[model samples]
Target: MAPSFYETLVERNKQYAETHNPAPTIAEQMALGRVFETTLVITCVDFRLNPDQFLQTKPEDQFLISRNPAGRVGPALQEIMLFDVFLGLKRVIVIHHTDCGGSQFKDADIREAHKSRLPDHSEIDHMVFGAFDEVEQSVRDDLHLLKTSPYVPKRISDQSLGFVYDIKTGLLTPVE
Candidate 1:
């Protein structure tokens, strides 16, 4: 048989480590305690929507990225608060994408699916799967939540933005 998954991953990682060469400016900025210059991005865990390409910027060392099912910030409240209060990050970019898997099901659909799969576990009721019916509305709702959250600093909250990424067109539309 071929190499196991972990073995393949290790081999690939070794290749990556040997070839990877980050910019010297990024290193210099890090040494001077200046890394990212702008907002934190909260986006879907979808494989299609790569933030660097969508934002048209290299985000490796220049952004604080948070990925969730629907790109909802509600589940990442603690991290967001810490970044805002201690790290001095003053803005947030919430990006929800078109045709996301998270938008394919409703809460009730998820609940029933879970019940069918595991008949004994009734606690799945307490889970909010963060499914979205409309992508833009989901972006708006998440933005509103972040702006109103007491945990988030006022400066960051005021500057928070929302967008919907179109996977087919590679276009980002502001959700307002």
Candidate 2:
């Protein structure tokens, strides 16, 4: 009787498109194949921690965002490699947040759950869920992983940084 879930999304997107205007300058740059200096931001898939809000910049600007299970750069290394090689990626910022759902469970727990729930699906056993315990340590580890990865350029790796976002306060603290 009513619109489906995807139909609702289409309607919402139509409404958003009506009010949100595309930046002509950014559009022109993209059209011209111009490579702009941009920072690659790796953050958790958590909806509470927004890269745009924390960085105070629009997506159209010089920011390439990658959201993953725990904000671990290792999982998204292919994308990072491509961006670094072609997208003028000069910096990398890894942001792991406090009170993350990924930190709530261990890898073993997730593996056991998957095994129990999907006994016939043995392929899931090899999957790395990226569940973590220490948020700050995870951030640092990710930063190190990015810095040491051969796929990431030395210039970008040298500038790589780590941060912990406080979901409750909407504040980011640098993780050294």
Which has the greatest TM-score?
A: 2
Question: Tens digit of lDDT per residue, candidate 1, span 82-139?
Answer: 7766656868889999899987878888889989999888898788988988888898
lDDT of 1 at 20: 91
Instruction: Please state the error at residue 159 of candidate 2 in Å.
Output: 0.8
Number of backbone collisions per candidate: 0, 0
The weakest ten consecutive residues by lDDT in model 2 span 21-30
lDDT of 1 at 56: 76
Location of the lowest summed lDDT over 10 successive residues in candidate 1 = 54-63
- Where does model 2 exceed 4 Å of error? 1-3, 24-27, 30-34, 117-123
- Regions more than 4 Å wrong, model 1: 22-38, 59-61, 116-122
